[model samples]
Each structure stands twice: as C-alpha cells, then as structure tokens.
Target: MAGYTVIDFETTGLSPRYGDRIVEIGVVKVSHEGEVYDAWSTLVNPQRDVGASRIHGITAKDVLTAPTFDDVAPALLDAVAGRIVAAHNASFDMRFLAAELERVGYVVGERTPPSVCTMRWSGAFLPGSSRRLRDCCASAGIEIVGEHSALADAFATAQLLASYLDRCGGRPMWGDEISAARAFRWPAPRPAAHTLTYKVRADRQPERADGWLDRIVARMPRSADSRVDSYLAVLEMAMLDGYLSLHEQDQLVEAAQSSVLSRPQVLALHAEYLHAMAAVALEDGILTADERSELDRAAACLGLAQHDVDDALAGAAGDDGADGLVISGISLTVGDRVTFTGEMRMERSVWEARARAVGLQPAGLARSTKLLVAADPDSLSGKASKARSYGVPIVDEAAFAKLMDRLEASAD
Candidate 1:
C-alpha cells in the first residue's frame, strides 16, 4: 500500500479543448493505511468568466480577487508530488490538471502520471453502484456536505479512496499504478509570489463581497438625467434567473454609462424594482415560499437588504393593489418566440404546449429567439451557450412560469 493524494478541480467548463479553464482545486493527502493526513483547497482566478456557475456554484465575482492558477501551481504540485495521485473520475481531473500544469510550465516526464480512478474502480468495489461522486458516496454512506466545491469534493473522494483501500484487505488493488507513481518524477515547481486575497464561496462567507452592483454604482456620476428605462430593461433581463452574471453585469454597466444614469438614479431604480417584485409576491394577499425566495434573490442582486423586501411588502399591502404580476424584465406576449434548453421538470412538449397556449411560438433557439427557458439558467449546453452569445435572455423554469402567469394575467 502507498500514500495517495486525492484531487478535484472545479473548472470553467467540461473540456480544456474548448478553452475552458480551472477556477478551483482541492487536494487531500492520505497515509498508506488510509488515514487522512492533510487537506487543502483554493479558488483559482481563471482570468475569464466562470462557466456554468449553476453547476459548480462558482461565480466570476467569487474568483475576481483570488490567485491565478500560476500563483497556486507550486503549492498544488507540492501536494501531489511523489504521491499516488487519485480522483473520482481521474481522467477528467487529469485532463484539466495536465492542461493547467503545461500552461504553467510543469512537466511530468514523457508520460502522464499513473492515477487511480475511484469511479472506474467503483464496479470492482461498490458493485451495482452508479459512478457519480455523489451517488457512489451515498452508496458507501459517506456524506458529501458540499457537492461541487473543490475542497469538499476532494475530501469526499479521499474518503471514497479510503473505502476502496479498506476493501483491499492488506493487498493493493492498484499496486502496479502505485509502483509507477513511485518512479514518476514531477517537474521542479517555480516559486509563486504569495497573494493575500483568497476567497471562499459566498454562502460560506459571513459577508457577501461587494459585487457588480456596487462596482457600477461607484463608477456612476452624481447628477445625471434619470433616463432609467433602458438600464432597467437590461437589469430585468440580467436578473431573469435571479443571478446577475458577469456578462450581464457588463451589459448593465454599459447601459448605465451610455445613458449617463447617475448613482442616485440607479439606486432609486433598484429600489423600485425590488418594490415591484415585492408587490407581485403580495398580489394574492399571501406570499408563498417561492415568491419570497424570488424576492430575496431580487433584493440580493439589486444590492438591497431583506428588510427592504419586508418594507416593500408592507408598502404594497397598503396600496390599493399591484398593477400586474411584475417580475422585473419578463414580459412575454402573443406571437413572442420562446425556446428551451436542458431538461425541464415538465416535459418539453408540455412546456411548448403551454407556450403556444399563451400565443408564444415554441421555436428552436436562434438569434431571433425572444427567450431561452433553461432547467439550469447557467446551463453549458450548446443552445444555452449560443443563446448567451446571441444576447438572448435565459431564465429558469420558475421564471418561465412567472412569464406565463404574466401573459395569462394580461389576457384576463
């Protein structure tokens, strides 16, 4: 038996062949006896937009001030050097690992280092179990508190490797691979200038980092004209999934700068937008859990506090009524063309039929497509990527339902 370094990487996308980069890396060292030794993880600044954030929960903002891959490469190499490297799906992790290492000028001799793929070996150990990390962990009764974060997944993989070792009964299932790893020599690591700006995912942090909204506000002048509809329209589209992506933030900032909207004007518009969402959430004389969640997301993106939602709900109840079901920028109408991507909770045919019921054309994704309703709004599928490139608004299933509700309400 040999010690192992279990690794996991959260990348910008699936393949490095498509120009995707790594945004985070986690490593866990375990002793030959399958005892946990050390665990480490860091958010890497990919220096590009974080792709498929919905899948990994890593946002561009999360890595904005973090160390770049080059900055962390030496530390990462030190962790895996002279150890039997392992991962759940070792091939996928190795692909990105090799790419990143090569980019940073670290070579592992003439061949890729031997790796133990827990997923590939799952059938041998946990027979009849699925290969997904979460699924396999569940089968082994190993709890993975964080599914997508790099460190959490790496630690889980380490435990999974330990389970496989326990099943080996003093023998090594991957003895040949371990022997090969012992002979594998890693390139000398280049020293990196240490940076003090590491960041955990927002949910784990006590305070949310000042994000896109704050940056845009800081750039705004004091007393410009209140031509806010243009900016507000862009804001509506940006927050369709209740997540203001980096690309969408760029769009909003451009709109604000172009229209010369002042700091006070933009702040006022955000307040109004929050109030409008609160009003709609209260339209039925009750705030459902879903509506409350939607309002919270809107407030967070708009840089408003939760108390703002409470205040807005109070003010809305005092008013005669809400004008209509307002969900910021969503306003689907008759003859509007909408499309969908990824798997929806409802059947594709069913959602298309519902779209057609409200006089919307359930069409294929194209530049002319008015909206793209995705199961995961940050979907990395071809259609979703194309829609983002084409500047099409992408919303999740719930937001699509809200759009349908608004359309049906208008008809009524």
Candidate 2:
C-alpha cells in the first residue's frame, strides 16, 4: 500500500441511528513512510439542530453558511478514495462516514474498506494506555492542542499512527488489512458539477481591514426604503457573540443586499437595535451596571461609538414615560413562558429555578414560548430554531441574567 487516509468527525452526537449527524470532518493523508501529504477539513451543515455543541465547539451559527453533507460528499469521497482509512476509534468514524455517504445516495454496501483503529491497537504499542485519543496521545508523548476539534484530533491521530509504523520496523503492521484494502472497491458516487467546502469561522483568517458592519454596508446599494426585518434578524444573530466572523459578515452583506438596504438605512437599523437594547435595559426603571456594560458591548459590535450608546441610552430613557420598549422582539412578562437550549455554564435546572423565582414560566419550546435563552444566542438547537420561527428573541446567558434582574425590579 502507499499511505493511509486518517479521518475524524465531530458530530452532533453518537449514532446516526438517533438522527445525529456530522457537523465537521477532518482528513489527513499520510504516505507509507508517515509523511503527511495533505490535511483538509470543513464544517458540514447537519440541516438539523447541532446536538451537544459543548463537546465539539461547533455552534449552530458556525455551520449557518456551511456546505451540507450532500454538497461536500463528492470532495470527501475523493479524499478517501483508494486509501486505507484510519481513525482513533475506527468503528465510530467509519460508521458515521458510511452513514453520511449512504445518505447522499452513495451505495455504500455492507462491506467497507480495511481500516486502522489507532485506539484499538494502543494496548500493544503503549501497554496499559487507555483507548481514549487524548490518553493515547499522552502516552506517545504527542500533544493534541484542540481536542474534540476534527482537524486537530485527526492530525494528532496521524502522528500516533506514524509512531506505530516507526515502532514496527518499517514494515506493514496489518498486512491482512492492507491486502483487504487493496482488494476492496469503493462505490461510485454521482458526479457533482461543483462540490463545496466551508471552514469554521475560527479556521479561516479573518478579513479585518475594516469592521464587519462597514463591509456589509459597503455591499449595499442606496435604496429609499430598504426592507429591515430580514436584515435586522441577521444582524441580531451576528451580534449574539458580540463579534462578527467572516462568514457572519458574508451573511450580513447578503441579507442587506438582498433586502436592498442602503448604507444610511442599515446604519439607522444599527442605531435602532442599540437603542432597543438600551430601552430594554432600562425597562425596570433602572439601568444596572451590567446592563450598561452589555449595551456598551452591543454598541462596539454594531461598530457604533460610545457617543452613539449615550444617544441610545438617552433616547431610550426619554421613552420611559411611553410604552416599555421591546428588544429584538423580546418582551418578558411575569407569566410569559421561556425556554432554553444548548449547553450553558449554569445548570439548566438552576436556570429554570431562577425563572420560577422571578415569576417567569420555564416551559418547553412552543409557539406560545415568549423567550428563548441559549448558550449561543445563534444556537441551531431544535428549541432555538422553533423559537426563531415563532419570532421569539434569543438571548445569551448574560442577557438572561440581566433580564432576571429587571424582572425582579419590576415585580417590586
């Protein structure tokens, strides 16, 4: 054989049988001598909520613009073609690979190519070492920097595989498997006119010559009355993290351009958004220090100066005598139902308890749900998705905490 194709997948959860899907995949090609030929990775949109993002660091927002498994199937097939597949836990990786390929209409028959499981053979190489990839890497004196990330784990596994090859006196350790791999035939997939690939925001070098908001505004043509709802929704999601990634910038630009929003109109929307946050902050008749800090961060993310925040706060405070302002479509009442999604730093039960203490009803996601609290405001969890479709405002934990404070004040 020539070399092995090492692969890894960061998935929504264990078992495609449970509707879990691959959110990201990493492939590393190494020569028989353990020389790395190429390493590639991409975020794969699962088309459903990304489950257990805490493990993989893949939020729903990260894959918002990513290519689906169907779109990237062609490229992935090409990568593993004619090569022995290797993974830390070969069965898990192989299972997901086969399942995903099958889902894309590839006739991945009952038989798959011979594969190497670095973890499976760890007992022989690093006697007494655990099967965990991190543990095996530690025993081999190899460091995995970004654990759980597909590419980082794949590269580390490649290094471990190289060590095994070196220890085995430069001969093929699995002669039978290699032979089987050589005889194995890969199923032909439908040829795609163009295949797509997308990296997570963290993987791509940011285009930071100017602020993301400015870049988005630049793409827009002047229009008298540009549609605001679509652009506003995109803006709210992008600001969830208080920092816009390159992909998010693209989303914003696309939203604005498609809506025919002009530079002035977009700027106005930004001002309105900040003002809305400010108004919400002061809804309880007081702007807590934390709320002010939150507004400041929002202002920075929107590419607005501190003066703009001051103006927004002043404007919002001036409106205190009028009907209370709602921020991003969120208006919380004492009995309004709220739902939460994604893994949060605080326990879900604790959040629910706090909600009850504040006279808010914590309930399952439904059309009647008034608010959605998410670890990532742009979470793609089923609850978050349903909440968005219902026009419920999603807020991060910090924002939720601030809201609780306001609720208590209002109740008093």
Candidate 3:
C-alpha cells in the first residue's frame, strides 16, 4: 500500500445531501514505507451552531473563531493528495469530504488515490462480531480513547487499518467491496445545481386548518398582537445547526398546535420563521457552513420541497446587519408580549409592579414577545443575545417606565 491517509469526521447528522455537515475533521497520513506524518485535526466554524454537541463535546464557543472549510481546504488537500484514503466508515467521511470540497470549488475524483472503509473489509476477516468502529477496534484489541472525537477516532482507525493489513496480508479477502469502494466518486455537479432548489412538495393542502384543536391552540396564551413569537423560539433552536432531528420536528408540530394556529397559519409562520433565521444567518455577510445547515433544516422542517437549500440561503443573504433581531421598525402594542432585561432605573420587581399597575401584560422571553425592556440596550447578557437571535428589539428600562407612565395617564 502506498502511503495512505486515514480520516474521520464528526458531523451534525448522517447525510450531506440532506444538509448534515462536518463540524470537525481529522486526517493522519502514513508514508508508503509505514512512517506516520504529523496529524492534522481542527474544529471548524460551521457558522450556525454545532450539532450533537454532547457526542463531540464541541461547543459554539469552541468553534467561534475556528477556520472555515474554505480557509483550510488547501491544507486538507495536501493531506489527502495522492494517498489511499481510509476511514472506519469511509463512505460517511468521504461523503462529507466530497461535499465540503465541492462547495469550495474543488471537485474530487476517486481514481487518484481511492477510498476504502475498514468496516467493510473487517467483516471478511472478523466474523460473528459487529462492524462498528469500536467493535472492530475492540476485536483487534485497539482501544479508542475518544470514540467520537475526530482526531482520536482517526488515530484509532489508523491502528485498525494497520491491523487489517497484518491479518489480510497482501491478498485481502474482500475484493469486490474494495474495488467498488475504489471506484466510488461523487457525481459531477449538474448545470446550476448549486442554485436550483428542489422545491419541497408542499404538503397536501389540508381541507380545514381552523378546527376545534385550532381554537384550543388559538385560545392558548399567545401575545396580544400575534402568536409568531412562540414558534420562532422553537424554530431558531431547531435550525441553529442546520438540521432538525425527528424529535425536534415533533416538538415544533406540537408547539404549533398549542399556539392555536391552523395548518395554513402554521405554514405561514414557518415561512416567516425561515426568513428570520435566514436574516440571522446572513448577518455575518458570507453565510457560514453552519448557517447553511440551519437554512436546510428550516426548509426541511417547514415542509419546503426545495432540493437546493442555497435557494433559502440566497433569499436571506442580503445585508440584514448583525444587530440580532430587528423588530424595531414594526408596529407594536402594550399587550403584545413584553419583558425586561439588564439593570434599570427601578428594581425589576418595581418595574414589573408598575407596568402591571398600568394594565401592561408581561410575557417571558418568547418568539412572539413584542418588546424587551433593558437597562442598557447594548447589554451582552444571555437574555439580550436570545432576544437578538429571535429578532426582538430591546428598549431600555427608562423608555419602558416612561411608556408605563403615559399608559397610566391615558387610563385615568
């Protein structure tokens, strides 16, 4: 075997075609003469949010300043260039690898060095045992220190590849699988494939969205102005990393029902939510990979039948500013879900009491929440960050108190 590169990817989900992406990658290269080169591994800024943080232990803070895929692609190309590519599940890694590479204007072919999965080959030599990475590693007595960490998994996989080489010798047993793997290449991009959206088949138009359940949901505590806030909170988190799990989808549907929105209203809210998230993603000018992932997740969850998430992305990529949510220009009212953040002229308790005295109904930090009263509009508190993410504007406490006084006078 010529010098080879063993790779591993920690991703947001299972499929790149469906918007799942690599948040991190590790590549270890071994020379043709069995000498290992320096290992290459790094956290990537997915630009939206990291997915499955528990499994990978990568947080938004961890990748906040990490290099983007385009920034590191040249170095990655050097690692994989002219080397046999190996992975525990080579297809998974290659799928992400190929997708990431193509997105940055480099289309890779399989013939140059070829790709192979150790899991496929392991079944031939080690029967009766499962082919999971750790299982195969365990069969070979190869301990995986950090099972899902891109670097550790890549290292462990490197050892497993060496073991497979020893057991199978020069004439490996799995010829057909190996050959198929060697020939696999991502298909060339279709004309304007990147721009064309495979529009999601809008669901069967429901006969009636305003049923008894709708009434009950509508009767639920939505803002006096609109129920949009309730949905956006759930939607923003759902698409933060570009892919929504089935569990999240169910939760969103249930939450939508509780909001008393009919099926049509639910769909309409989904569109608005998509635009808001898009605006957030585009706040940084160039939409980062994580942001793209989120747009894809939103499109999928919102029942958009677009094949190309880039379309959703394109719609949101305008100069929307990075000031968080921008509800400043819209008409808002007193009972339309309001809350307070930051230190204010009066104590929070006092402010709340006074506001309530004037018949101003207060709500929590929710999506449909109309206004936020802050001591400092520029406070970087967690609550402020959330308000920005949900596109709610922050009006300082002094402003709020003045408004409350005006309301009291008007009432009298």
Candidate 4:
C-alpha cells in the first residue's frame, strides 16, 4: 500500500445532521517509508459559533478573516484525491467533509478514496490500554505538541501510525493481501427505495392515519446502524399522524419491542421511543387501560421511572397549548414560530413545542429566520453578536413560560 493522509477536523459541534459545520482542517501525508512527506492546515469560516472553543482554544475572532470552506475545498480535494484518508475517528471527519463537499456540488463518486479509522484499529490491536492519541503517543514514546490544534493532532496521529508500523516490523514490503486490505472503495449510494421519508398528515390525526407507518419505515436507511432509529421514527410518525387505532399502535409498539436487535444500546433507544409514543398516545386519550399497562411495562424494562414517564406525558399534552399566551397582558394563540438557545435541560422537542404554543415562531437567529428565543437572553452566544446582528427579538424561556402559565391560569 502507498502511504496515507492522516486527517483531523475541528468542527462547530458533534453532529453534522444538526447544521454543525467544520471550522478547521489538518492533514499530514505519510510516505510508504513511514515518514511525514507533507503537512497542511487551514481555518475555514464555519459561519457559526464555536461551541467548544474553551477546549480547542480556536474562536470566531481567530477565524474572522479566514477563507470559507469553498475557498479551500478545491485544494483539499486535490491533496487527498488518490490517498487513503486516515483519522482518529475517521467517520466523524469523513461524514462532515462529505456533507460539506456534497453541498458545494462536489461529487464524491463511487470511486471516492477510502478512509481508515485509527481509533478502531487501535482498540482491536492494543486491547486493555487507553487508545486516545495523547496516551498512545506517550506510551509509544512519540512527541506531540499543540494538542487540540488541527495540525498538531494530525501530527500526533501520524506519529502513532508510524509507531504501529514499527512495532509490526519496520517497513514490511506490501503484498497483494496487504494491498487488498488497504484498498479504497467508495460506498455505493443506497437505492432510493430504501431511503426513509418523514410524512405528516394534513389533518394531523394520529388514529385515522394511513401511510404514515409505511412512509416512516421507507425513510429509514436499510443499514444496520440505523435500524433502531428507523423503528423509533416509525413510532414517532405514528403519534404525529394521529391515525393509528389504539390497538394498531399498541401492536406496532409490541413489534418494535420484540424485533429490536440484541444490542443494549439499540434496545435502550427503542425503549425510549416506545415510552415517548405511549406518553403521546395516553395524552391524546387514544390508549386503553391494557395498552397503558403494557407501555408501563416497556418503560420498566428500560429502567425508566414513573415520574419520568409522567413528565414526558405532561410535556406531550401541553405541546399544543390549551390556552393562549399573554404578551404584556395580550393573549396570543399557539403555533407561532420562535427560537431558543442557551442552557436547557428540557428535551429539544418539548422546548420547541412550548415555543410554538405561545404564538411565537421558534427559529435560529440566522439571516433566514425572523425570530429568536434566547433561553439565556443576556448570554453572549444566545442574543449578542451574530444573533443580535440579525435583529431578531430574544426572550428568556422562563419569561415565555411565565406568559404561558398566566395564559393557562386565566383560561382555567
């Protein structure tokens, strides 16, 4: 095998699905002889907040004048075009890069280069020892500096790769077996028929719904990693559509509980989905006594408390407020768009529904949005800087909740 590119990216947040973007990238090219042949690093404007700046020490000000991802994408593509892209957590970097590249009209075709995850390999090979790059490097006597900086992390990863190669036997000649093991094959795009889609009914009735279950099942990726998510999506869609007969919904929940994989994590997520759906069903007055007992049993299987179930049920019931909000003593109806930020212990769905119930539109303070609900209205990130620049109104969640309380009390 001909060498590989050790890559790392400092992203705005953990998940790419939640609109997070990458702010910086680093790569160190290692030759077949296990020597660093070239190095590259760039700070790209993520166009958003650097949430974990305290840990990485790279801030919005540091990247203020930096080039956008588009500006440096071509060069980045050229550098790693034919090389294996290796990283500590390769999927994290790869998924974000792939999404961004796809957004900019870049075709990462079926022949796209392969990516190797050092973390996965290390865990398999170096069993019973810490696999973190810093710890691995220290144990292997490799020098690394500037821990969180992109280039520094890349360099550290490269050193670890080199050490692994040395321990295996310095500069072993590559053979067909090794070559095949290191071969790069692009992932085939899953067929459209297997893709999952989220569908909502015009009437928003959960019990009389047709096609909702099928639509949710279709939306789930046929991959093993997403099967649990697919089941959960089905349950949520059933609730949202309000078309499932109480018996049919109960059977569907039973199917999910019975058919889930043996993996505890997958089962746990399914349990949560079942619990949430049950709560929604109960609040909607669609569940029978027996079905409610079954759901309670499911929650017990997952080690969830009755109080937790009650809280979730309350949130679902209050989702579309029964009363209008009082804005300076003025009553405003529900379904209005609003936005929220800052510290919130409530589930995001619950928070979002509360915002909508107050006759306010929940939205992020980007140029595209018209409103902002700052949970911590005075916090620098919530309402100041870019959010303030967009001229969106910021209100604390507490204030919004207070208005909602007053409205409900008046109605009562």
Off by over 4 Å in 3: 31-37, 109-114, 172-244, 247-412
Give candidate 3's root-mean-square deviation (CA, Å). 23.5
How does candidate 4 score on lDDT?
Answer: 0.54
Clash numbers, per candidate: 0, 0, 19, 27
Per-residue CA lDDT of model 2 for 47-146, tens digit only, reads 9998656457778899989999988888787777788889876766776788888888888788644688786566457754544677779889999878
- State the lDDT of candidate 1 residue by residue for 198-289, as single tens digits: 55666552233444333222222111111243355346435635777655555565556654665665666676666666665665688878
* TM-score list, all predictions: 0.49, 0.49, 0.43, 0.45
| Residue pairs whose backbone atoms clash in candidate 2 | none
lDDT of 3 at 107: 65
Candidate 4 per-residue C-alpha lDDT over 1-412 given as tens digits, one digit per residue, 9 for 90 to 100? 4567888887775545556688778889876567886887877778788655644567777677777676667667665656667777565577677777776666765332346655534532343333356655665677777766787889888877776666557643223224543654433332233322211112211132234323222222111122233344334433433334454345344435433434454444544444344444554466567555654554554446666556545654655421111112122345444566776767667877755655556665566454455545434563444555564444455546655676556556
* Candidate ordering by TM-score (highest first): 1, 2, 4, 3
CA lDDT, every prediction? Answer: 0.70, 0.70, 0.59, 0.54
lDDT of 3 by residue, 77-148 (tens): 666655577887565566678778777787666332347667645644554334356666777888987666
In candidate 1, stretches whose alpha carbon ends up further than 4 angstroms from where it belongs are: 195-197, 204-412
User: What ranges in model 4 sit over 4 Å off?
Assistant: 109-113, 170-412
- Model 2 misplaced regions, further than 4 Å: 201-412
Measured with C-alpha atoms, the lDDT of residue 287 in candidate 1 is: 83
